[model samples]
Target: MPKNSIKQDENINNISNKDLLIRLFSYLKPYKLRVFLILILLIYVMLCGLLNPYLMKIAIDKYISSKNLQGLILLAIAMFILNFLSMIASKTSIQMLSKVTNKILLKIRQQLYEHIQKLSFSFFDNRPVGKILARVIGDVNSLQELFSTSLTSFIPEILTLICVTFIMFYMNFVLALMAIIVIPFLSITLFSIETISRKRWQNYRRKRSNLNAYTHEDFSGIKIIQGFSEEEKTSRSFLVLTKDMMDSFVKAVRLNDSFWPIVTLSSGVGTILVFFYGISLLKSNRITIGTMVAFIAYISMFWRPIINISNFYNTLITNFAAGERIFEILDIKPDITTIKNDIMPKITGTVEFKDLTFSYNNDATILNKLNFKIYPGETVALVGPTGSGKTTIVNLISRFYDPTKGSVLIDNINIKYVNLESLRSQMGIMLQDTFLFSSTIMENIRYGKLDATDEEVIAASKSANAHAFIMNLENSYNTEVNERGSRLSVGQRQLISFARALLANPRILILDEATSNIDTHTEKLVQSGIQKLLTGRTSFVIAHRLSTIRNADRIMVIDKGNIAESGTHKELMKLKGLYYDLFMSQYKFLD
Candidate 1:
């Protein structure tokens, strides 16, 4: 089970039904003009429904009793016209509700997506992509019925109930009391059921999210499962999650399904009680037979809305479960924000860390209160053992994360005060694992600079040494990259990413294991091009392969959250320290 859940974070008992309803209905305010029109149409339809029972009463008391066939015909015609108009209004109201519900859902989804985009990387580090997707896709979809029935079913049925109840009391108050005698008991039973049902349904939603998250994770790592011959292991894991989801679903639905039966039983009891009481009133000549007949008709009309309202209450609870999750996501404030940030102007390529310190989720410090400076046009290389804060350094420079204690400065201006977009826009970063979108090679390269000309793209590709292979393809630059560039080799994909960064023409470039995926032959092919691209730019190259950074102006060997060694390749080799040990181990088997 996932550690995250609503109950764990919030005591839902604190959120009253009124507050939830108020918040949910606030979404309706945007389309209030249309909603008002819909309500008017629904009221018309409800009034038509309320009239039918009285018309039958009139037929019994006046028109049919006199054997006045023409009067009866006129009454029937009037009832038919009323029913026809009601049907048209009902249909029109439903159509309007659909459009309104869909628009509100779209607005909600857009807000969720935009908020998620603004959140800092640390927020994502603790959550799975699949869990996030479940809220965005499945949880958001659950609110559709709440919106649809709010206008189409809930409001109309409620109004009909009110009108029908009032008419029954007006016709005969004593019998009206007798007819609804079972209601208090029914309401008490429903209140108990709803409280328990809400919690169960919330559990089911959580289980379903867990199941979805596991399925997505399994599929994403299908290759690893197959490579290790762990298909049966994965299958067992999937079955466990599926069974958990099924159990919770069955429990929740079983409780929810009992609602209708309970409602039917209560309605049956109410009708029987009314039938007996109406007989007493008729026998005593307290009410006319037509009025007795209309009372029974009104009883059915009244109880039917109660049944519908009970069902709507079930829908409301289910939607509340979904709404809680959606609101939880929307309620999150982005940890890192561009608020009150100053836009960074173009600068010389000098970068410095000033007493910088950071930790992931506030774990053990990855970077201590260290300080360093790289001058304009310097080609610096960072070499370290695994988990030596190499990536964190570049990430800080790009403003992906704020330092815990101090700041990173570009040209002596603290990046903490700089707008993230403006800060990152000046740097080119190529990560170890490259990702390509579904588009043609040309478009993927042009992504670096949306308005770059074809000539510029071609020039960048040539400088990155990607032009040769791209041109050899059947469709050349027009060839599709496919999903994550699966159709292309690792070297080809990395080369395309190289071209993308090159096209950006950034003043400060950081290549973090950019050539790790490429074979030695492919690495050699791009070595000269890499040097050319690095020329006159402040560059940070993080590589495990010592040979790649042999010509760097300086190499910093990071160790235990601090720089252990810093010098040219020869200087580090002469020191015979940690850098010397790492350099020897990498090439010991080569020669």
Candidate 2:
């Protein structure tokens, strides 16, 4: 099994039936009026059904037995009319219920999506995108059964069961006991099946999630897989996951399928007991032939609801795992509040790190108690070997992660005290790996400034040197780049991302190898526009190329979780320290 699957299984905390039922039922609170109407309709249908058997009893004893043909015909007509109305009410009620349940499903999915959005980066960091997607899309859909069955079937089944029980006992106590003789045993059997089946279904859901995670990761990295010729290896892994899910599904379904048979068998036995004893009652003249016949009808009614309730119970048990997974995500409190807080600071972009200390997963320290300051409008270039805290430095400035111990100040005000929106809104930080939504070029560019005009988008694109290429496309600005801008060239994607950040026009701009993908000609073309965009705004640029960082106001060489050296390019080259070593290394990579 995948390590993620193991972790997923470990994270499954047991949710009690009471808590699960209460939470699931709470979704119907907003649609209670509709539920009430459904109840009235179902109750009317039930009364019509109950009246059926009693009418037969009256027809046999009071009308047919007395040879009163007129009364019998009238009674037959009344029964037909009752059944017709019941049919109409039942159809209308089911239609109304279908609408109600679908709306409830939409409500639940919306809440899940909103909750997932609020969660901090740390939540995403630990989980796979496929796993998260499974919860949001697959797990949320699994709950449709719970919503549909609970409202349309479960409640009415219980009510019907109760009403049938009362009518049975009232007609004749002994015959009623005979009618329900097998119920206690039937209950025990179904309970046992449910107890065993619940765990199996839970296992199946986890396996399904595991399969989803693997499939997502596999497809997402398909380019790499094909590049490395690892298709067969991935296929074998997929087969294993499929077999695991298949085995679990079969086990759960087999147990659930057994439930109906046992209920049907029990119903058969109860009817046989009723008939055998009712014959003895008839012989003793303790019950009428009409009453005996009615008892048979009531016996079928009694078992009908039992069968319905058992089916609903099976559905509940199967989908209970899905419910738990959903609530588990909803119950999570975001590590950081995403909502706009009370403190909103006007930023001039002076960044300071005071005794900064950080670690990821409480493991190795990525940044040791480091301290530094960059003046407003200063262009600080961060250069370092891999894992030397280059990206971590900018991530801290953006307040993406709270420091393990220390404070980051924007304009001398602790950024932790400032509202997240207020802080991030004033800062534009673009990662080396650029991402674009499945949208048009214009829309993607407009994301940074929601109300940006078409001309402004073109201006920003021109500033990034992306205008030339975009104008050559089929739809120009309206052309959809598809997911993550997969259709665009690497440099084109980065350029559009650059345009987006540029459109934001932040007071502070952090470019993490922003021009890495652009060809030399494109980079040279945009350098002047880039400088203008950087002018009068505090900027942090993390790049490897000497040409990119040589022009920076101050170059900070980061290594071993701290600043190894800091100075202008020439001054650092004169120092003959870590900065000069880095510069010489890049300088040696000549054409």
Candidate 3:
């Protein structure tokens, strides 16, 4: 990865609000009917708002002015009925909007998940899980306010403004024109403030995501930090990030605060203009007293929707920014994808890498023209110094990445032309660090093969030498493993992982330095289990310890991403190459 990509913060402003809105609205395509129905309800609600001032005018001019008590009672009842009907429509619209919004959110989340799953290992290697999660869950959630509140409120508020403006103009054109003049200035001020606030808020969102990433990394690696007595340093680092996040958030809130007061003062000015100007018309007897009173109500009513329109625009911008973040993840096309015509091929577990050149980036190579083959039922050990591309080789075999040049073949079929699931399903891999999900021990073991029976699980566990220790626990297979299996000791976790691989019953097995961190006793137990497990499968073992691979059918010493030496222990020792020197250096320790 380049240094530019290595930085945690990437420029997120590449996609604009309009582009995000277009994408988000596309997701809403499926729920179009529900959205339309919600809009209709909103329109009805706005109609009710327009009718209220008119109804009050009727009560004042017809009932009160004529001194007809019965007319007053009837008008009051009519007003109550309109409000009741509006309330029902409002409630129904909210409920429907909530349901549709949730569905849209679910679709976005599912697409994000599928995209992430399809991404190459290199993408994950470069991006943090916390950052991906922020895009999927946190940023997607920010759109809820947009869909639920903004959608229903915005449409009706806009329609209400138009309707009220029309009604005011019809009642008295000059007064309505004068009252509306403040709109342009108010809009300009609100929009300017909203733009600044939204930018600040976007920064706040980025910082919040970074904070989440730091917190997740800290907690996940807490054991290591505590063991090395670096807790205080980690805590201080976290506090600094937290403080920065809080400061950004405060800046956004302060920006929002400055604008609300201005809008309020502007609305107050518009109201004073309407009242003072209308009373002069009343004194001149140019309009009825009731008309003046109704005009005042309309003035109050009209400005609210205008203010709401400004508020909605502010909300829309913030949500659009969040939507852009979410779409950025959704837009990531995987670098490596299975060939459309790929199909599973019959295999005898004979693996071959033919002139494979690989790189994490286009500029530099990690493995250069690597050529190797493992015969059926053979256990091959790869020994290399750090950064010698040992792990890269295993990654190639699994097709977690495709080679930049040449091919990796299994049973004479290029792995690239094989179904990814089929290729991966036929192999079992246990990395040095085993990860277990939050579930029972049995469930974790069964995760290797979702449909594996209890008897099979026990048999596989026994083969991995994990059954005895598990039975010693209070709940045995029923014992709960917390997130990442943190409750289990390192050896115990390895034992369970081994059992999982065994239950998978793969034709090819990969043990990537499995015993690198376990205690000596546990290593012996795991090594013994591995010996039993490798009986009928082609196995590749990457190890630092010479003893672990000494008895292998073949061992290859890798140097600088190329094979420097290869042979059985005895043959390699006789030849006295890189393997011979490495083995001799540790021969006495094993003894």
Candidate 4:
């Protein structure tokens, strides 16, 4: 298995729910005033709710039993007014809290995205694109309901429970005592269920992330599956992944669903206890009939809030699990970080690798102790057998991955000591797999230098020999290249990439099999363009096409992470080393 795959199997640190909640709520600090207003509205609504039961008691005792029709009518009018006010307050609170929730979500998503961008390449190397997408989009969205309810339901329910308990005790202590007897039992049951449910919910989320990763991988590779006639096999694999996700979801839901029933059972027991005890008090004339009725209403109020609070706790646990996953990424310190006082200076393209050695995860080393230097304005060709560390060398030069030992230097300064943006800006790299965004051809070429004008983009395209085909398109340079440039041919995509690189006008250039996929005709066109582009830049070329490198100032044959041969092509051919053998293998027919 690949080193990255093994790294993915390692578990992330388990963060406590308390810590997760603290971090999650930190996003709400900026919207405190909106939250404060919502809190006031909720308290007002709770007050309105409390009034209805007390008013009912007054109407029953002073008006209904006494046949005071006028008093009863006035009380009914007051009740209606209170209900209307409550509705308005509730609606206003919802509107305000919704705005706060959306803003918090926006901030969280933005922070996650920006943090992901700052992370080093190794972070991405060990994780799938889809899994990262799941955390960014899916996991972050799971907190939306939690944020919305925190103010609307959670706060109001807690206040109602406290107010109801106090009012119950104020009316009659004995009945209040009886009503709450079942609460301790309910609390214990919920605590046990929550402990079990938390684990189940975490498993469900992991399964969900895995399924998303698998689905994305399949879609991205659907063409390969179809070409190989393995659609049924792929579908079977997808079904298995989805089934695992469903199983985990069902288990979590089952545990969560059990919670409501327990709450309901406890609610019923509390009401029964309060009813029987209140009847005894009424028989003794210690409490009036209206008071007895009010006690029952308060009991219902008390139990309903208990149920809401319980549900809120369950929601909190689930969202907390998601917050843990999100914070896991946020907690990762970027492997590559710029020095606090790093300098930003223009590079002259003199590149050096001093005793450089590298390995992925301390696994077998890809490059050994290697030392080499390339002068400014030199074009060097690196030829080797497969897995000879050709691409690794270029990656090191670009600082995509730092050397595990030793250093890479440019212009007599360590690349690590230089600001990454300044260092990378002066370097341009093109790979075999050309990636273009779903944008117009002009925008794609302009990506190399964001501020380049239209005329400059056109000049870059013409220099790359991409202008002719781009003009033939339906909208010329304005034509949209679909996702990953799928709308364009492989050769066309490579030429566009070349145009982008040329537009950057970097002091250093690295091309790793850039033209290996193009046909002879396209290669000829790109070859001329590349020659012009490499005129004054230090360039590294890795190619299987020997003809392209014959004119290079130096040709180095790398073998087992060491330079086996180095000299111009003519000098290496006369020496008949690895380079000569590779050249003969590809173009003996020319001789």
Candidate 5:
């Protein structure tokens, strides 16, 4: 298993249920009027339902037993009208609730997506993309039932329970007491079951997240699995994750399924007790037959609400686990955030690292007490062995990561105090692995400057030597590039990336092995275009090919996180230092 897989299994601390619920329901505040109207409609529906049983009691005592046909027909018609109105109210309330719930869901999903975008890159570094997707798409979806049913079903049931209890006592206190005798025992059982089920639900959600993460990773790397002939092994591993998720779901459902039986048994016991006691009351002439029948009807009505409430509790417990998972991400404080009064000045592109020391997770230093300055419009080439902090230096200048100690400055301004958007917007970076979105060639190039005109986009492409190939495509600049530009060759992708960078017209440009993947012939073709793009911009180039940096104004050989040599290429060749050794190693064949 990969190291990230192990990290995924680590336990997540859940917030208290009370706090989670408070925060979750806050999303409903915006639709208060709609919720209020739904509540009123639901109350009316419950009242209409309650009236039917009383009408039945009246028919039995005043009309059926007495054989009064006129009275019976009148009561039957009334019952029908009441039932019809109840149906209308129920339907209307549900429709309204659905609209409100869906709108709230849209807002929640939007907020989550925007928050994820603002989060620092470090957050993404440790989490799987699939796991994040599960939170935004799956976890948010789990709350749909809660939203739709809470106002229409759950709240109405609570009101029903209260109303039934009061009406039962008013009719006959002794019979009402008998009907509710088993409630305390039922409540205890439910509370105990809920305690056990909450943990099981948490486990189920965690396992589901893991399964999603695994599936996403496997599909993303399907090409590698085929290349290595490890399809069977990968399939077995996925099965293990799937099986774990299934087991957890089954265990949670088993506990949830127990709830209905307990409620049913309790209701049965209450009804039996009420029946025998009511018969005794009637026999002793303490209550009329009509009252006895009404008591029985109330007993049935009473337990129905209890059953609905119990089911709502079950739904709450399950979705509470999902809610906890979602809020955890929302609670994370981004490592990088802009100050309220941050500056957005136009950059002159003079970058300086002042007494900088940095580490990842405070493990080992990658750059130590580094100090360097590049004047505006100077092109500096960096050559270093792998892991010698070549990329780290450029990353610092771009403000991707803050130094553990000291500061990085741009145009005599501390980057930490500058608006992140303003700082990054003025800089263009093209890495060895060029990433192009699944979009048309023109749109992908225009991504650097969203408002760039079509003519400007075409001009930029021509400057990067990409216009000729783009014109040959079936749709010219309109041709679609598949995900990450997989449809284009390596050289074509790099040139498009260059076009994108050139279109940005940034003051600072960093190229990290931008031509590393291109063939020799392709590199020769792009070399002039690259020089033209870097002519008036401050540039940092990390190149392994010594020939590419021969004309660089200055070349710095970085070793062990420090500059081992710095001078023009010809000046460094006479020094016989690290730069000389690296150059000789690459072009020794020519000698």
Candidate 6:
């Protein structure tokens, strides 16, 4: 049973006909000449198939029963020549078609990869990386069957059936008519089953996509699961999802399996009927034995094309689902895009948010109609309770997400009027959750400025107080951070992120809870380093530890998406407002 399931899974990965044809046509658009050549070879192969049975009938009628050795010799040589040519044609057709199909798959995967990179951030946020990868690689690869087999074979199969039928009718009208009676019945039944199967197949695809997403999320977060000792719980959860996936697959198979057997049985019954009726005609001398023999051969050859045509229905379903998934992604318009003819001007770090209002969804606002400005060379600290829009404000500043209303200006120009890359190039950000690539420490720091030299990387690391700890390591600047910086301590990761930001040399710097992870001593070290970096630059710092931002040129105390207080820390302290109350609350704990 386990072996059987493994085989079933292998078949399920194949693309259905709809997706296959759509993909093949699109990919083959560039290789139309090759595709046409493949089709021509297939037509030649099908013509050979049509001639084979006719050759047998001629030999049997003119030589075998006539006791003529010379005639038999010529017939045998003719048969051998036709067989040899058929073999060559078949081999050439298969090889050419297989190579073309594989090339199409390569093109499809490349296009999918390129298109996905251009998709907006919101699309990735809503979809899983594993599912996207599966669509690009797994789903696209599955379509090989349609191109290599179905597409190349389809025209030949139909042509062979037609040619064989016409020859059989010319020989004996009654026998040919009797044999073809099952065609319409088989076709109608296959069509109905295929329609139902396609819907089930689509559902199966969705479930599989969901399964991939869950498995990816689970494996990526394995460390967190182990840290919380939730392995058993996670396994149980995964088991439920796998079970549903299996059930969906089983249902699709059941529908697909039913059609194949019905087709096989229908062909068997038709052949039996043809044999009985043809023999009666032969015994009555209505048709010659040679004619009866040729008709039987045609009957046997006939059902293969029918079966192939029927099976293409299932293949079409798989392809349709795959095509829909691919098109769905390609159709999405990026939420943020650069405007036509917009050019960013040189900036001097001044920033202003005028009546900014935003909501992640349409429901409730996260940032209300509010206005604030930071002059050149000023440090503005944003302090707020959880869910008070501190990070949202910074996100808008970086153009990660745009405001639903109002304007954000940098150097007196609305951000929307500038080229996205140019506007963002003048700014640097370090989020609370730092992301490090699985590369060297030097590369991580150089990520901020792709052209930074080794010396510059070291300088940036020193400015962020990350150079000492990095140098203490065995590999120092060449140390691999591993995936998501898993090999580094939280404090070390934060330091590296700060170093990356420093390398950018931005006129506008954003520190979103940058010092939240370091120890008290390390925090003090980072604080001193930050003061040096922040000098002569406009900076926005979001700090949970209010003491870190006490010397800010201005402090904005935010509450529920509105700026409730704005002033120097000393002046805000005199008001004894929300900021004072929150700071004093934390101060008592410190005391």
Per-candidate TM-scores read 0.95, 0.96, 0.94, 0.97, 0.96, 0.90
In candidate 1, what are the lDDT values of residues 109-203, reduced to their tens digit?
Answer: 88889988998877676667777898899988999998887777788898888888888889888888887888999999999999999888788
Indicate whether candidate 1 or candidate 5 has the larger TM-score: 5
Report the CA-based lDDT of candidate 2 relative to the real structure: 0.88
TM-score winner, 3 or 5? 5
Please give the TM-score that candidate 5 achieves against the real structure. Answer: 0.96
Q: lDDT per model, in order?
A: 0.86, 0.88, 0.83, 0.87, 0.87, 0.82
Off by over 4 Å in 1: 1-16
Stretches of candidate 4 above 4 Å error?
A: 1-10, 589-591
lDDT score for candidate 6 against the true structure: 0.82
Question: What TM-score number comes out for model 6?
Answer: 0.90
Comparison by lDDT, 3 against 5, better one: 5
Clashing pairs in 2: none
- After best superposition, candidate 6 residue 19: deviation in angstroms? 9.6
Worst 10 residues of 5 by lDDT: 1-10
Q: What is the model-wide C-alpha lDDT for candidate 1?
A: 0.86
Off by over 4 Å in 5: 1-7, 589-591
Candidate 2 deviant stretches above 4 angstroms: 1-10, 338-340
Residues 98-195 of candidate 2 have per-residue lDDT tens digits of 89888988998999999988777777887777777888899888888777777667788788888888998999888788878888899899888888
Q: Please, what are the lDDT tens digits per residue for candidate 6 over residues 1-591?
A: 011111122123435555646645777788788778878877877777777787888889988888888988988888788778878877887888888888888887887888787665566765667677768876787778766656555677777778777877888787777778777887787778878877777777777776777778888989899999999998887787788778888998898888888888888888888888888987889988888888888887888787776676567665666666666566667677766637777678889999999987565899899799889999999999999999889988888877899989888888876788887888889998899999999999999999999999999998888999999998999999899999999999999999999999988999999999888988888888899889999999999999899989999999999999999999999999999999999999999
Residue-by-residue lDDT tens digits, candidate 4, 103-200: 99999999999999988878888788878888999999999988887777788899999999999999999899999999899999999998999888
In angstroms, how far off is 110's CA in candidate 3? 2.9
lDDT of 5 by residue, 230-315 (tens): 99998898899889999999999999999999999999999998888888888899988887877777888899889888988898
